[model samples]
Target: MLQISLFRRIVIFAILIGGLVLALPNAFYTRVEQSNDARAVIESGLSNDDLSAVAGQWPDFLPSGLVNLGLDLRGGAHLLVEVQVEDVYAGRLDALWPEVRDVLAAERDTVGFVTREESGTDELRVRISEAEGAARALELVRGLARPVVTVTGAGASDIAVSADGPVLTVTLSEAERVATDNRTMQQALEIIRRRIDEAGTREPTIQRQGADRILVQVPGVGSAQEVKDLIGTTAQLTFNPVITRTTDPATNVAPDEILAPSLDEEGVFFVLERAPVVSGEELVDAQPSFDQNGRPAVSFRFNPSGARAFGDYTAENIGAPFAIVLDGEVISAPTIQSHIPGGSGIITGRFTAEESTNLAVLLRAGALPAGLTFLEERTIGPELGQDSIDKGKLAAAVGLALVIVFMGLSYGLFGWFANLALILNLCMIFGVLSLLGATLTLPGIAGIVLTVGMAVDANVLVFERIREELKTAKGPARAIELGYSRALSAIIDANITTLITASILYAVGSGPVRGFAITLGLGIVTSVFTAIFVTRLFIVLWFERRRPRTIEV
Candidate 1:
């Protein structure tokens, strides 16, 4: 008779069971749909099974012997966005320049236009527009502005707006650029978060990177790809005159540096050739609406700079048309009747309520520094993702069935014990996954299936070893002891190789691939423990209980 202690048997069983428990949580419970009836029963102190019946239970927890589901199975949305701040900044700056120019041009327009004088380094030239009017505009402006940017030539009829060496003509410094970039990035992330959350998307991850960039990830989301259109439009606002090439001579002007927008288009509207009199950058807010004429439109209000620019531009360009263009598409063109110095106004044009709201948000949030050119876009339909999940499930089931049949036929009675151990191995896998919150991707499922074969391999090795030892006519106990000792080397070699692969995959891959690595690695570990110890425990127990003459292979 072979000599093997019961203590050793108990020790093996405990290790195997412990491993199974650890992996069960992650694997079997990918999602637990809590039923209120069940919960109420529990609260009312009912048995779990009774509560389950009253409410409803799911096989959602796959049999104790399977892999966990990953994000794909759980079904969620993933979105990637790049924060293009230049579009907003440049748009804002371009918008502001028009207003500033309009106000500056007012003095000239009212002054009846005069020659510009070159005074040393500073542009201290004068005598252009009406003096009193220029003073009024400057007084309104000098009250609130961007820091202490010098406004030279503000004293005379020609208001020379300048910050001296710090003129708008100069480029931004490293610090300014960096600061601006940080602010843009910061705003982009915050705004995006708000949008995603506002859309009722939860558990999102938003990150900011190099100069005005953000990355957002939303898990457990349905109806993917819709988030893109939600984030990228620029809502710039302006007021100008409507012009058609046929009616306005400038539209048919010689096409050279400034290409006259095609007059053939019904949407084409032109105003005075002069720059915009007011910018939307100064706009504090915008809301969509229906004008008295029953056209969709957006209303807006501006900050100080915008007010002065609007007032001055209107004062000089009175009766001239101004074009309100957004993202290269002219929204409207209206003639200036009276000066608007409040920095607030309305934009009336073709727009739906949703369209208007989006525009308003975009404008209120400020324009992007640069227009977004779709670098790359991919859309995953819900049906497609769901189909993948179905296929993955089918593959897993087929692999598992084959594993069971193969083990049962080849190893005979001993195979029965191995199958049991395999089930335990699966439990170990799921338990660990659930506890650790591991997601099982398709590759991860494959790994688990592959492990079924591997777990069986260990069993086959032990069984063959025992069968070989039985040739010497040893008792079942002695045969099992020798089999386990001999098989340990092969089992170690096989499982270690799998573990190394899992480690590499985890290290190199991202997202789902990483999920695969985690589950696979976990499978290898759980497989080894259950195959080596749990199987041995049952084999030893059988020998002790029966005192069999000879152990079957």
Candidate 2:
């Protein structure tokens, strides 16, 4: 007998109602989006009359999860940026200089006076007064070389040290350079992601394109320039020992000193040591706060190693000024009043609250390992996106209408049940997408349209089987039961094969391909549920109520 248990019917209706409720927000996407944004702001401890009003647009009891629109559907910024990985080579050598200087200085009797010499960007050159000690200096510096920390570079040293006359040159080895490049790219990607996420963007496609390039696509951003502004600042902060302050920008400086302009004071420059006492890499936390004068400032705290170094530097250099540099410009040059042991400090300057907040965000995200050169940039307009949405809606509506008409003409009353199931299947797809926070692209819309046609296949198979079974003199109930039972295997087999394909596409593909795979895979699951269970339940209910003895397909 065609029948569904009372509990099974309740479960089915509960699921259907739950899905419909979850998918309800998408029906008023704009209002719900504004409400969600306003609610987030309120939760972040900010609320105004306008924000409160906007937040009340949707009821508090409803599910607010939305199917995020992809770049193609929402319009956004696209960028192809190439990281300047070579910049790290110069910084690496600069960092290695202090170690080499200290090691050679310890053996001053043999090495004589040591001085850094001008060299290529990738190599560090140190000259000793005594030529006879060149070999000794080379040997000592070579001891500083460690094995590269990569599988392909296991046996290779990080630095190659060689001697020529009285000068010893140290350069990063090829293997180490390759490894450094990989790390640089990884770090750049992470920092970029962090910076964008901090700005509250959604569904950003940030992935490596080539060896040194990244592809960034942020949906719903105003322009590419806005995205660039968010990520362009390197935020490299360091505290350097100040040598002297000068008004002339043309002051000659030593090889180990750098002349940096003051961020707040015009025409004022500070000559500072190239090597920093502590760098921003050691900073564990940064927050927007007020300085002693109650002015907007950024408070920062360092890790243990950074704290120890910072404490030692301040203890030894009381009454001397230290320049707080960010991206090669000194923001503040404050004189040490006493030994500051805690490693917590305030950076005070002429700054507004917004600037301080943005700086805090950047500091928390850490500095980019290398600078980026924008190779390509594009801003997609909202008008174009709206056109795409309109077209996509038309395509989906047309596909749905054709499928509904075909099913109704072919399968009679059973066809109406199948059509209803198909509608619910779409609702379920949207519900699942909202629950997963999946992005919908143009290709994803195509997947939904394709699903509309495919959702009826199982019903078609069952209906045809019932027509055939009726020819064998089986009653309506027996024919219906056998039709569904016999068609189950075929339905499962066909959908399983398609699911495997969708999974593979999702695993290996990116961006639009991924969007398509997600929708297609989700559609298959929902279609099977609506076909085998939902349509069957509807038929069972009709048969139980009407108690029909004769049926026509």
Candidate 3:
């Protein structure tokens, strides 16, 4: 006979009620989203009476999570970016010069002086003055090389150093190049995500595409150009000691220094040391603020290690000028009057409030290791997304109505129970999605539509088995039990196979494909629960209360 313990019944009802409660927020999505946003702002230490009012719109007792609509469903900008990994090669070689020079200079009695010569874009060449000391110079440079730690890079040096006649050639090794490429891609993805997140845009998809490419999709961001503008900036902030201030372009500066034009003043140039005392990567915080002159500026604080480095540099180089370089332009060149032990300072430039705010955002996001070159870009309009959403809703409603009518006419009272369970299954799908903060895309809607049809298939199988059991001279209770028990294996088998397919899709695909897989997988789980447990519980309760002696098929 069909029977359910009070505890089992209560647990099933509790799950259904919990799912309904979680799914409730989506009905008032805009207000709940606003409340969530306001709550986040208040939690971030901002004081605003209006935020309190907004946050109170959603009840505190209710779950505030809502399903995130994807780029296709909400409209956005899409971009395919290829990171220029090779650009880091020249920089790596340029940075290696100081170490190479210092090492070679120690053995000056034997190797003599060395001078850098023009070479390939990816190579570093140093011409030793004495040809007899070339072997010693090469050995000294090779000592600077370290083993690459990565799996594929095992036993390989970070750089390849060789003696070519009187000159020594240096280039990044194959192993180090692979490691550098991986690091560059990861750093680029993180910086881009940070920059977009700081802008307060919702649910941006920033992911790696293959080896060197990044795929970026920002929902509600209208134009690809806008997103490009936000992440394209290589905001490399560094404080370099001023080698000299020169008006003449031909002023001979050391090879270790670079001449950068002043941002505030025209035609003025500050020749600064190529090695930075502190880089923006070391910055812990940055915000827009006013300088002592009441001009718009950005205030920044460094991490502990950077604080010590900056403090030491300032203490030793008192009275010397240090150039603050942003990108390729010198923002300011100020004389160090005293030691600045606290590594917090303001960047003074001729910037408007908006410019200062944007600069602060970039600085806070940190610098990208390599620049991105946009390979492809497109903007999806909100109108198209709305149309898709409208059509998807219509398709789902029509499908649901047709299925309900067919099931009701075919199976009578039992059909009504299956239809009710089907409706709850959809609620559970969205509820679980919201709970998990899953994104819903256009393909995801299609998955839901597919699920609506498949959900009834298990019920149909069970109903047919019951009809067959009735002809075998079994009573209604015995027939129902046999139907459900025998159909359970087929139901589990079919849904499990489909769930495996969705899992594979989620694993291998990106963006909309993953969204589809997510909804399909969740739908399968919810449908199985409602079919085997929820629908059965409803039938058992009815039969127990009524205690029917006979039933029509």
Task: Quote each prediction's TM-score.
Answer: 0.50, 0.97, 0.96
**In order, what lDDT does every prediction score?**
0.59, 0.95, 0.91
Candidate 3 least-lDDT 10 residues: 248-257
Which candidate has the top score in TM-score?
Answer: 2
TM-score of 1: 0.50
- Quote the lDDT for 374 in model 2: 95
Local error of candidate 2 at residue 109 (angstroms): 2.4
Q: Clashing residue pairs, candidate 2? A: none
Model 1 has an lDDT value of: 0.59
List runs of model 1 lying over 4 Å from the truth. 1-31, 34-71, 74-76, 85-220, 225-382, 471-475
How many residue-pair clashes does candidate 3 contain? 0
Order the numbered candidates by lDDT, best leading.
2, 3, 1
